[model samples]
Target: MSEQSVLFVEDDEALRFATVQALELAGLSVRAFAGAEAALAALPTDFDGVIVSDIRMPRIDGLQLLARVRALDKDLPVILVTGHGDVPMAVAALRDGAFDFLTKPFATDHLVAAIARALERRALVIENRRLRAALAAGETDSPLIGESAAMVRLRGAIERLATADLDVLVEGETGTGKELAALLLHRLGPRRARPFVAVDCTTLSEDGGAADLFGHAADSVAHTRLSRVGAVVASSGGTLLLDAVDDLSPAIQAALLRVIEEREVQPIGAERAEAVNLRVVATSRGDLAAAAAAGRFRGDLYHRLAITRLHLPPLREREHDRMLLFAAFVDQAREALARPDHAIGEAERHHVLAHGWPGNVRELRNYAFACVLAADDAPGEDRQDLPSRVAEFETRVIVDALRASAGNVVKAVELLGIPRKTLYYKLGRYGIDPDAFRRQGT
Candidate 1:
């Protein structure tokens, strides 16, 4: 069964119901909307689902909705249903980024196949977005990517600690990729194949948050129809990432501490505590120790989580990694916008190195986006767009990641979000030293 969802929009109720039923019968989830307007209003910016819409709607036609969706996220897949006469318009829609167009009276099976293709594309686009975001935060699925000694030491410590199975606390400045480090730890450790769940501490409420974490029994709440199992128990035999743990309320802190201490969870309205085996990885942007010392956070809980700690290095502190990261982000932005790569001049290079990067990698990402968007808009007569200079820079970014990983092609590919075969091809194209980058005596 497909895990992805589809937003199906049609003005005709009968067609909508029939199509939605067919999709559901085909083991796909469908949310039917009466018109394009409702679908547009219901869609989220980070919608992970595909959309199927009739192009000839009464108001806010599919083409207009496609335009709006593109404005929000260019990668969103918008599949249009076109009439026999509207084939030309559908072709035009393709040029404007519609995933695919379906003609009227198409087979239900054909529609399902199209939906599958759209879902596949949607998955790739969203995954690429996530990968870039992680990279910009100075972290990767494999591990931290940096040539700096600070990063080297951090990776070494994490590697040693990953095998210990102890709960971890990751502290760093905001946007410094604390969660990514935790994810890397989980991915590299013994629980790699098990579930890795992440809960944002700040998003939970005192009343429901406790129940949400520890779960509630059936009829425990006034409205909920079924019993709930919380994060702690759900993550058994795996890992639970507590993001922004410092924001956890005192009440939640106490409840969480009890769970940590007991190694079990007593669900709301349940008579017994269920024993659980799992690892906890907590992330905090501020000083957790100070919070504990100030009595704002539970000191015992802090001690439990802080047993193993890793501090992420800020972008400015790592000289070589910053430019390497910037180039990658530039590449990301260029690819996202479907623009040619940027050609960074000496002046642009100096500017990148000189800036304070107060917001760290996030600020650098925005600057990179601005640089890419400024392609033809750059002023002065002799001003060349950044894409022109990106030919060698892209190769350099690839080489830097490869070099940092010491010729571990798999690790470099993971860091650069490129395929192993593709990187090898590029390596040959660029005449890079896959061996020279190998760590000495390794």
Candidate 2:
């Protein structure tokens, strides 16, 4: 089935057939089940669709099914339908994390609209997860790419710690790629094939935040009817990244300390604690030690999470890597936008060198794309024509290749993926002295 399809459960044969027909006519792809058991059994862990079930069913009812689905994947949208629903039941369902509730005799349009909205939200959630993973994992071999000494040391530490399986705390400023470092640790570690779940502590609210991270048992949380799995449990056998860990509420921090200490989580209202095996990677912008000492953060939690630590240097501190990263980002942007190569003019080079890049690589990458897209709009003769820009890009590429190859024309040609004669022709056209690089390196 396509990820865009839906799973629908209803016990009534006539209503099930009629609703399925209506949903199909409304251009939705749906799989109809006679009971909740069948639907629950067919559920996929990475299901990207919506679930609509009649709340008043035998054996496994809609609310029970919703609870099970939440335990499986909290983000999966479950819409409960019942002709017997009262105001309180509906309110309770919503509070219990039901996506939406519909009463029978409800208009076909109303159900369809509800399903559409649920599907839309599901798509956004899935896409956000995908994009976040991609951003953290990156499109390159190494998530952290630079030749700076700080980067080299950080990479070595990460490689060593990744295999040790110790919980790690990454300290860095915003946009310093803390998430990326956490992801690298996950990827390079034994849990590479497992889930990499990242939670933003800043967005965790006091009202239901603990339930969100630690999960809740059915009826454990007030006005809630479902048992939901939390992120900590969801990341079992993998890596749980606590981004901005210092931002966690004191209550959550205290709860998290137990999970880290015991390697088990007791769900709200649950009788037994469940054992979980996962690596925890926490990131903090501020000094967690200071926060803990000041009582702003839990001292015990910080000490537990900091079993191993990696600190990423800000962009300004990596002076040697600025131009290298800028060039790479520009190339990526040009390729993504399917545009002609962007000539790095004096203005761009100067800005790359001079700017503080408070947002680090993220800010630099955005600027690179902006420059590529706005190349034509550069003011006062700073912008060159397509041919001139292409020529300039060509020169830079050849120079870089030569530098990498130690000015060995044969090696440079191979590195550039070009014919030797073609590389020679370009080198002659651009007036680049290959021997200059050779003398400096080889």
Candidate 3:
């Protein structure tokens, strides 16, 4: 394994040289500086090393250096060396965020142990930062693919919304990429470095609501004995994506409304209110307006959320981009399967375009995966067998579309190419109840 780096700052030449030699013998890279000024000048913001320094030094002292390091990197550990009489000053350093204080004439083993712990802490911090960067990259690269006019407009809207800080309401059918859009907004927005919290309103219940969204204090009656950190607190300086806001209970809705209106959040058991700086993006598959009219949703909440509503049209309406989306999905499936590049035959492309994908891009992706798997299993099958496989594929597609479209004959006919009479016949043949597919609203 590679050696960890250590920066040792001590005014005493004998102690500094001896310490450097000891650390070097232990397979660590040591940089010795006789004063704090030299060490501070050489330190870079991205330096990954444990800092060991004597508490008493001329010109710039160890405490001053510790403060400077804290300003640059709070996670960087600083271990202070002190004499028996200087223990009081060492304790003061601890209150100022020093990692730990060591008495002089300390055992070599004790010094090595402290250095190991500090290096381990530095490693963990670096790993966390790396993971966060990877996550942000994924968000930027994996955007929704479509070329229809509606999709183009939606993309433009996202680009515009991402530049500002405002509440967003994304209205779309299930699997229409609302969450993906929210992520894009976050990655492109000013709060990109902050948290991106997602909350499912449908899953929020009174039993553990506070514990789930707002963390409990160490001492409180409703603490539940187990400390919990809520998503709202986790996403302090970023964006919060509230999925299915229509399902928010009245009480929880009121709490969320206050949070949004006041721009602050009070913990479940805390007396003080903590300020929150985040953009709110709410998504829903149902019609909020109708829900509000039916008393199923709060009118005030709906108005607050609908400040800038962007609707995602169903895939069936985006006929111009159907083939483009199909090709994209094929490429994604190929990469995922680790297969050689594959192309959709002209016939296969035509078959895909003929049907209306009611399940939207999600259904197309599933079909692509299934088709690839089937082809892999029967590598030698001729085009003569293609129709049977295609028919099976069509059946599955129709079933999913019907389920998503809720069996409305006209919508089903629009989604599937079959006539209204033929759709009803297939629904009966497939043991599907048309009434069960009907949504609450026409």
Candidate 4:
């Protein structure tokens, strides 16, 4: 295991010595600073450690240091040590973005627990930063390939929204590149340097109604009895992409609304809420208005999330973009498989253009990969027939998944192991009736 570092700041000599001794004994590398100024001067933005400081230090106190730290790294965890009477001050420190506070004269166990929590918070910050960096380097342009009017307009919207700090709600059919659009927005925005945390709300449900957006406290309890930090608390100073927000239960929706409204997240086991600066972006294939009307989603939350909505047009509507996207996917497939350039034959292009891509861009990419694999396998046969085989394989997978689920849309969705909306979109693409099984009373 890697060693955890801690920066301990306390004006009291005896208390500082005892605290450093305790931390060191707990297997932490301690950097003790007698005053806040000394600690603040040495702590840079790249310092990945927990900051334990007294709330009532002499010059440039804990709050000021916290403010300075926030300016440099918003996710750094700062634990404030306060006297018994300084509860109000501790609360103020929390509002000013302190991770957590411990009252003075507390037991060593209490202090150690606080430090452990701070370290956990620091680790999350580092992870989030790394993820954001990867996203920035990987996705700068619209992932959807097309030159049709709808595609042009969609890309324009993404470009325009990328410049602002506002929340975005992406509405599109399955495989319409909702995640891709979200990634483009994050890369294009000011918070590109920060993290982009994506959550699949559909997979997180407790008892069919209560869903854990952040992990449960009960799940985090251990033999040592320390509570682990949850995902919502982990993603600070960045974007949190909640996929399938439509699937979230009403209880989870209410909790989410509180986080967005307060700009803070209360971890499952923590007594206090940690202040966070997050840009929220939600995606859904269902009509949010209908969900709200049915009381499945909160009305206020819907309004809050839909501040700016971007709709992605389906593949059929973007006919002009299809050829461009197909060519782009072909090039990408070749590069991905380390194969030489292979042209799309005239017959293959005709078939591709004539057949409606119900799976949208993602479906096309899969087909392209299959074509490349097929071409590689054929030593002397005509490579031009590879596209048709790829298409056939794609169709087979779709049909098999549908058949396994007995035509039950929801069950088929589970069998396909894709998003509910994506499964529905594929059914539509293949001209399968979603309610066919229900109509037959099967």
Estimate, for each residue in 8-87, the C-alpha lDDT of model 2 and write its tens digit.
99999999999999989899999999998999889887788999998889999988998999998888989888752143
Q: Whole-model lDDT, candidate 2?
A: 0.83
Model 2 misplaced stretches (Cα beyond 4 Å): 1-141, 379-442
Candidate 3 C-alpha error for residue 214, in Å: 2.4
For each candidate, how many residue pairs have backbone atoms clashing (under 3 Å)? 8, 0, 1, 2
Expressed as tens digits, the lDDT of each residue in 1-442 for candidate 1 is 2788999999998999899899999999899999877888889878888999998888699999899899988878888886532434755776677777766666788688888877866775565465456666756434466667888788888888888899999998887778878888888899999999999998899788998799989988878868998999889999999999999998899889988888999988988999999999999988999999999889999999999889987878877776666667778788899997465544455777898877777787788888888875775322323443233344546655765678888887877665688778878877886777786418
Q: Name the lDDT of candidate 4.
A: 0.73
RMSD in Å for model 3: 33.5
Best by lDDT: 2
Between candidates 1 and 2, the one scoring higher on TM-score is 2
* Candidate 4: regions farther than 4 A off: 1-141, 207-212, 215-224, 377-442
Candidate number that wins on lDDT, 1 or 3: 1
Q: Which parts of model 1 are misplaced by more than 4 Å? A: 1-143, 379-442
Assess candidate 3 and give its TM-score to the true structure: 0.53
After superposition, the stretches of candidate 3 with alpha carbons farther than 4 Å from their true spots are: 1-142, 219-224, 380-442
